[model samples]
Target: MLVSTRLGAARQIADEAALALRPEHPEYFSAIPPPDPKALRSDVGGDLSQLFLLLALVCLFIGAVGIANTTLVSVMERTAEIELGRALGARGLHITVQFLAESTLLGLLGGLVGTSLGMVGVVVVCAVQKWTPVLATRAEFVAASSPCRNW
Candidate 1:
């Protein structure tokens, strides 16, 4: 596999460097060669991943706030209906459970719809560009596939 090959090369390089460093002129022979151009790229990838995580967290927080606001508004608008239900024997806990279930369903539906839309967009872009989709070329995939790239 590509991973084993990369790891083997890295190990060979490290062993050579170790030998080189033990020579009389240690300064001339560094412990390791300069950073690999390909390997150095992963630092940028790590930064991008961190940025994506931060953005995703922010979006999730905003979505939660929006959902909370909507729930509050719904509760206010249906106060009379809720009161009628309560009078008909529905307890406060039952009402709370009903609202939570409704919210959960709404969230699930929205997620499914969004995911479908995203996939469609990706397909459209690839079609327009006449390019094959590389669904598994993400940073994690590449890192796992190439051992020498591991930090």
Candidate 2:
């Protein structure tokens, strides 16, 4: 019960055919034009794509804020340790570097492990569906795992 005409002239032919049948069928039958893919995509796909991009941006913002908040809480909670370091003659720069190193190592470790597990999952699913598994190279992997970027 679906009809499609590629050419405008064919559409006109179909329209005339529908009109010829209309009197016999009275109100029971009607002819409708197939949608224009480009126009439909512009109208709906544009909004949907923008909406998803916005959603991804919001998620990234929330994750960065969460990481910052957690780091702050951790430093605040380790006041005794920081004081001990200072008492042992550790300079402020040393303490700062120590915290940054700890945070970076932990973050990098988690990122690598997570990415590995995700790749494994992708391979498993692709195998199950009979598809080829694509994986990132070392440079691409490192780039994706690293967060800091210059504008």
Indicate which candidate wins on lDDT: 2
lDDT for each residue of candidate 2 in 1-151, tens digit (9 for 90 to 100): 5665557655575566665667676457666666666788787967776786787678557756766677788899999999999999999999999888877776667567756776677667777777766555773364232222222
Window of ten residues with lowest summed lDDT in model 2: 142-151
Taken over the whole model, the C-alpha lDDT of each candidate is 0.66, 0.68
TM-score of each: 0.64, 0.56
Kindly list the per-residue Cα lDDT of model 1 for residues 1-151, writing each as its tens digit. Answer: 1222353376566546645656665455544444666777888878877887787678678878878888899999999999999999999999999999988887767666755565566657777777654443452222222212111
**How much is the lDDT of residue 123 in candidate 2?**
68
Off by over 4 Å in 2: 5-59, 138-151
Prediction-by-prediction clash tally: 0, 0
RMSD (CA, Å), candidate 2 to true, equals 8.0
